[model samples]
Target: MQVAIDGPAGAGKSTIAKKLAAVYGMTYLDTGAMYRCIAHCVLNQGGNFENTDDIIRIAEKAAITFDGDRVFCNNKEVTEEIRTPLVSRHTSDVACIREVRELLVRQQKAYAKDHAVVMDGRDIGSVVLPDADFKFFLDADVLERARRRKKELDERGIVKSLEKIAQEINQRDDNDRNREEGPLIQMADAIVIDTTGKSIEQVCDAMRKYIDGAKA
Candidate 1:
């Protein structure tokens, strides 16, 4: 079983994807983390984001893998490193490159071939797993999404103004939607869930109903 969830950042894609994966006994693949891995790689190497060739080269040579919730890039654990604000700001730089997305998408597709996976990202449903058994597009108000992101960062001891975070999210939305490569999009067949005022449990339970009904 393959489940593809697509949404902007902080729409609870990762959180809900993990929950659904566990409940259904499927592996959860955070495809956004894979792109972040490439971004983190470029930063560590002191490569320029504007240099698409350099970014692509870094992505080509980076080895990214996931173990449970931990993310590894080139054998180094970067679960936390990739989530830093710095990396988050630059992730779209690498993700927008055609070569970079192609490289990561290949890896994502290969993993699904071997495992019953629940994968989430900007382009998972539309590009990476177009024929997935289930496709969901999760959305929330921009301010609500920003609040969720701020909460996560606060828990990590990273403090940023809510206004600034909301601005960044808006920028990210534009980038994800406008990028030339595999962009973030909601497929017509996908189940669209507006999670503006919903709790994680609420969202998960709602999705479970759909899956359960299909199974029945």
Candidate 2:
């Protein structure tokens, strides 16, 4: 089984994907983290974002893997490192590179070919797993999404103004939707779920009903 969940940042795609993966006994692949891994690598190497060649070089050499919830890039654990606001802001830079997207998408596809996987990202449903057994597009109000991100950062003692976070999310939305390669788009066949005021359990249950009904 392959499940593709696509959405903008902080729409709870990773959280819901993980939950659904565990419930269905599937491997959860955080495709966003893979891009973040490349961004993180470039940041570490002091590579310029505008230098597409340098970014592609970093991406080609990036060996990203997931062990449960931990993310490893180039054999180094970056689970927490990639979640930083810095990496989050720069992920779209590397993700927009066509060569980088092609490289990572191949890896994502190979993983799904070998395992029953639940993958989430901006373009998973529309690009990476076009033939996925199940596809979902999760969305929420921009303000709500910002609040969700602020809460996560707060838990880690990383304080940031809600307004600022909202601004950044808006910027990210623009970048993701406008990017030339593997842009964030809702596939026509995807089940759209507006999680604006819903609990994770509620959202999960709603998606589960779709999958369960199909199975039955």
Candidate 3:
């Protein structure tokens, strides 16, 4: 069974989905990582990010792979490189490109075709896997999300003011929701989980209940 997890930035979709995948012995696909990988490549190659044609060309030729949590670009490990503040900002911009989303969506679909996978992204449930066996929309208040994102960056020794982090989070939400190719939205059938004030294990347990019920 394929599980689609969709959420806005800092909603814990990736964390929860990774745990769910491990619990159920499913393949975990970090769709965001794919976009970030492309973004990393674009910046490294010094391409004009505003040039859609150039961006798409780089995306199409990108050789991206994942070894557990480590992301490889052209056989070079860039797991840490893609998570930098610069690439983080660039990823938000690159993620909205129509051609980029199309290419990744095709790859994401192919991954789910023959695997029991747990995939998470902004548009997974609503666009990438509309018929997924299980779907979830995880969310939290803007402030709470900003806090989580700050903590994540802090762990990487990247410090930024909460106000600035909040601003970036809000901007990303707007772009993900307003983008033309695959706007982010909560699907009707998806189980909505408010992740505010909840621990990772708590969220995973709540999701587990639903996965268990559905399988029964």
**Candidate 1, which segments miss by more than 4 Å at Cα?**
none
Candidate 1 per-residue lDDT, tens place, 25-103, comes to 9999999999899889999999999999999888889998888999998999999999999999999988899988888
Q: In angstroms, give how far residue 18 of model 1 lies from its true place.
A: 0.3
Provide the lDDT at 68 for model 1: 94
Tell me the TM-score of each prediction against the true structure: 0.99, 0.99, 0.98
Q: What is residue 57's positional error in candidate 1, in angstroms?
A: 0.8
Q: How well is each residue in 30-112 modelled by candidate 3, as lDDT tens digits?
A: 99999999999999998888899999999999989988888998899998999888998989778889889999999999989
Clashes of 2: 0
**How far is 25's C-alpha from truth in model 3 (Å)?**
0.4
lDDT of 2 by residue, 1-216 (tens): 999999888888999999999999999998998999999999999999999999998888888877899989888999999999999999999999999999999988988899999999999988889999999999999999999999999999999999999999999999999999999999999999999999999999999999999999
Score candidate 2 by TM-score against the native.
Answer: 0.99
Alpha carbon lDDT of residue 191, candidate 1? 98
For each candidate, what is the lDDT?
0.94, 0.94, 0.92
Candidate 2: lDDT of 169?
Answer: 99
Tally clashes: model 1: 0
